[model samples]
Target: MTKYLVFTVLYLAMYAHAGSVVLTDDVVNIRNFEIGYLINSPHTYTIDEAIQAEFTPAPNRLSLPSNQLDIWVRFSVRNASDSVIACNIHNSISYFNRVMDFYETRNGVILDQKHIDLFAWTGDTKLLHGTDSVLPIHLNPGEEKTYYFHFVSPAYQYFEYLILDDQHTLAELSTKNIFPVLLVGMLIALACFNFLLFFSARYKEYLYYSLYLVSSIIWFVFEYGILSHYFGIYGMRGHLTSYGLLSATIFLSLFVKKVLQTAKFYPLQNLALNSTIVLLVLNLLWGVVNFFNALDISVYFFIYAIAVYFWVSISLMRQGNTLVKYLLAAQLFFIFFALFGILFYEGYLPYNWWTRYSIAIGVTVEAFILAYLLSHRIKLLKVDLETDSLTGAFNRRTLFDQFMQESKRISALESLVFVIFDIDQFKLYNDTYGHPKGDDILKIIIHHLQSQFPESSVFRLGGEEFALLFTAENAAAAQRKVSDIRLAIEHLSLAFPESRHGVVTASFGASVIESGRIQNFNELYQQTDARLYQAKHNGRNCVVM
Candidate 1:
């Protein structure tokens, strides 16, 4: 029995030194290094027992599969320098909410101890500046110390550790964080720009896009530890991270539905998009009630939502939707890069900047492209609303707007002439030949009128009624131009079988106003209508000026 006991003690001693890291330089990267894990709760094993626990090498990065277990990691550092050295043990992941107990021991006796709880908002105040937990160590030349870390979290956690000279650690951390800081700044600027656009255009899609930017910015700032330095809020990082991700998903879905007009072309995809939003909302509610495990299941839902969005975008692109091409280009890079980033964080991929800040870069490109698309869409909608579909002339709304603008620019020496004309005996002609033929005759008349008075602005006031505004050199010139248009219509001699003259005819009325006169469009319209009445009474096919 005494021999067996000695053998067990020897085995424990050998296992404890198996994962030692020999420190021979100024810095040591402990990532993916040999380490041992105790997959039991903290209370289940003492520091000595944990040191004797079976050891396994972690992946390039370490990740816990489930949140319900506590993991104990053990590694040793041997100081090979000729003089005493001071170093800092740093864990760069700031988004995890966990409690860590660090122990340093020599010859089976603990020499120093420290505790860091990311969710407690206390402990290791000096470490706050670096936005992570840090342990300072002093080791004499040729001395070796074994370290143990007890980590407890309720969600998957990541670990990336580095040991560096204490003096240069803070400076190096600042330099490493510069790019993420710039990324968050750019995202905030984009959010503000889109927010202002939403107000100016009153477009719901712009509002959704702005909200998406805000959510993404919040997630990036918090995930990258930028907010951890200034805020004392603890235990809320995981919840806030989940909130930002879920809200971003909802906003992105809404924005795509509106921008792509999915309801019209891809109704099934639109329905699926909405369903994902509802599921996200439910997940958010679940998170609110149970904060610890809120994101454990919701992350999969987020993946599904992103998949639905990509499918809809691709389907639209396949249908020859030009605007969707921009969406596809912007979202494709973002989705793939973001997926890689998440995998990297979960320890499925090696650490790199592309995997770290992929979402930020993707979002920046998306914001610029989407803003351009919104502006272009607004311009096209304006054109559609202001144009007359039938006659290709400016509609009444556009005519009024142009007239108001022209009135503002008129000089004292300029003269404005307004002309109103319509088909004579138009009701009788329509009653005899039907409305389709009447429409064709109207189209022919408009074609001729537009050709004759190419220099003037024309408008179709209503059925069988048209108007033109001419700013010629003088009133005489305007009158001569009007007479030419009247003579051209008579020469056309368009056949109208039911007319008394067996031909189409029209009457014209004109009202000329000198530049000095301050006359509104309503006044000019009345004067022109009176002249039109006189021309109709004097027998159709004549011009009254």
Candidate 2:
């Protein structure tokens, strides 16, 4: 439907210079070829002088490339239909132009002139109906009018003229125009969430990613005219776009370095990343010092940075860096869609919804992918923190944490049991066979305890001392569980000839209490330890509860 409407409007606009527009109820919107002539001059011209000046046929897209010059567009409209026609002419490229002057004239007489100052915080620059650079035109039947627009800017400009009739279409268009900018807000919200997570995780990668998200948010705000259209902020547009991209690239490099562990595993790549970041920072500072016309330069550098980051991920993934795969997947999504959006702007792809809003879609997907990857990383970090390195048993700290958590639960219907045990004459066995053998015996003991209780609840308290905590139906059931663990350890086939049993064995001590009656982990630990002392005195391998 939109393509058909655009085609009909273009067909009428093509003959607009030879004849007038035959307005009808079906002509809801017109764009691109509405302007009849374009004049690119080295100096500004008044509306009176512009009327007599020579002009050339205007194309749908024109580039204004000089800060010292101005460009003017002139067009005429007539309502041949029988009813009054109300429509709006909007400059979608208003952000690229620092100053926009619209002149409405009839019969060589100036009737209305409106000025939009891009740098101003009030008046003409303010958002109207949540849109920008709009000039409402109302014409009665048989009325003819001519309109002229003057534009001045520092960098390249894309002038997209859109005319829409005032029949609920303007509000619909406003919503479509604002949708992409609202996606930037989603990125901003994700950045805030990661920033808060950084405080709890204390991971520098999270911090870097958060900062990168913020820079990306700023870049999109500038690139899509949101800064000027929504905030009425204009001057330094080039500088903000360039600097924001560079900043984002730097932080993304940092995030890749930390997440992939490049510094530890791939020092040369890490050095390359650092060197690229330094160069980007230097360019950023140079732009700040000089008037910041380095958008092209920044774009080139940004592409180079992305290439280097991509190489690092591919190289690391090949070298068995498991985390790099996720990074590569995320970057692929961003690069593919963003490149298509860039190509669309460069006229390589036909104008369509996908090509137009590709960047917003790309960023939204990549943000969520990175967020999930970060969450998975935090879970792995938690596992590493809780498990013992040598025997793969839960550490002492984990034991205490589990105790605290279980104590907080009010729905427990069973008694909680805490058991402490150690290999009989472990020191003697170590002195006789060696410390390596002693370590193996400790691993074996943990394995047997893991068979009885969960690996998460099997704790390695210290050298050769292990613990287990679980819920039991009663004290007798808890003692039976501890005895079963002791029997499993004794049944191990490994020989420890220095012991009285001529085989590896462990003494067990247990303390049981009703659920939700716990006071402190240390108190329970002390009670279990004293019973373990009694077991040691009673015999070399026995259970004391």
Candidate 3:
């Protein structure tokens, strides 16, 4: 008799522990529940059968076994407060399950039933826009209601139910959604900036990157349900999502190829990129032909493309491609977050804000890194185009460009100074010491001027001749700065046996124009050239201002 009594008590305690959830105004997240699931069940059960089915206490995390099964979660909540309570039952994370039927019952009589088909084109308009399964209910004082959730999907899903007051739901959603929205906005801004760069520089890589960003933006917005919820765009979910991924693959490959100059540097990698692009184009066409049915296979194509990109990046990095470092870092970030998201979806990691939005967060980081890489590339290209290779001074073309730009900005308070100078006897120096030593002297002269003036203002205008452009308060200030430059050039004690002096020296001719005295660059150049001849006539290695 004692053994039987102990067994009975244990059984009753087990059932009681999984019994009704007593709800109060303070109860925000509901946890206690009874779950009964069938793995690959051959037959479906009716609502009556499901209501009478036996269930065990649910674990903290309930993982689905297979898509070919049914799951039922039951929990009864009784209002323990005097005032009416409005609550929402929904998944903690935003993910769509194919078929979710929610039922509210009182003593085996149904109060409310909702069938949610997330992928359907038409459904309950409110729920259709929602990313997750939501069931809102009102409980009067002392009212008890039993809730049942039945789920079926083509793929495995994990549902973590949350019961919260309406205000708490709003607050929680706002807190969760704010970062992703901001990240998307940042990505859009980056895309726009890249577009502008593409227009300004006419770089194919920038256009490809902008396109990649646009596709990624589309993918993230639709994947997270923002388009449907906020913008009321419900159609073309699958096609758009697949199109975004496919087009992103194509454009990113183009961007990498163009930026890395793979065809010129690494022919094999270039061929690989070309092949990947072709395959993706085929996949894109396949998607278009098959419609939404092709969406299931699009992810695999994307994964394969990303693997190719990663391999190419690593290979280039191994071959001493310095720019590949940024690409590799971006790839690693994306892969890490993508893997973490997969783990979260597969129930290995706990559901949290970071886990839920890991992909978007990673992509955002990757986008900025790539953008920085592109900007760095552009800076390097600009440097190569504008500067002399030997002495690191602005070339003749840049000299004219700078003068034109400065002309536009000159005002009544500003004066422009143009100085042209050359080595007093460069030909004799080159003949005596050979061209290489003459080259050394030219570099030294340019270096001396660079230390005093902005590098952009100091120009190597072919051979040993150079030009300097600067702004000053007045003519006196401009003359003082030019004299200082002449002195600095003389101070560079480079060997030049052909010079009248033992050390190398240069002659300077400067022309200053005050504000409102507008002279074109050619006129200014002619004036400075005349002064240069005057300086040579007066005495070699003197300043003619």
> Which candidate comes out best when scored by TM-score?
2
lDDT of 2 by residue, 1-545 (tens): 99999999998876554423445653657654535444455545777888777666655444333333367887777777788888887666666656778888887688898887655534465433333567888888888888888876655444666677776455645564566677887888889888888998689878998998888887777666676556655655433664666688788888877776778879988998997798788877877766445554666787888788788878887888767778888889999998977776555665556776797788778878887777777777787799898898988888877887756652577887788988888888899989997888788778766766562278888998888887788889888888877788888867977678889988888888886677677888898999998999998588888
- Candidates 1 and 3 compared: the better one by TM-score is 1
lDDT of 1 by residue, 1-545 (tens): 99999999999976766677777765654444566566765458777787677756663246554543577777778887787777877766643656777899887788877776667666754554445667788888899998888777656566666677765676656676677788778778878987897898787887888898888877777666667644644456544765786688888888888887778777887898899889988987987888656677877887888678678778877778777777777677677667776776565666556766766776667767776776666666677788677877777788777877776677777777788998888998889888998898888878887887787888888888888887766788888888888777767898886665678988999987777774878887888988998999998778898
Between candidates 1 and 3, the one scoring higher on lDDT is: 3
TM-score to true structure, per model: 0.77, 0.80, 0.74
lDDT for predicted candidate 1 compared with the true structure: 0.74
Writing each residue's lDDT as its tens digit, candidate 3 over 209-233 gives: 9999999988887666666546655
What CA RMSD would you report for each candidate? 6.9, 5.8, 5.5
Q: Please give the range of 10 consecutive residues that has the lowest summed lDDT in model 1.
A: 59-68
Q: Residue 293, candidate 3: how far off, in angstroms?
A: 7.4
Least accurate stretch of 10 residues (summed lDDT) in model 2?
60-69
How many clashes show up in model 3?
0
Candidate numbers, best TM-score first, in rank order: 2, 1, 3
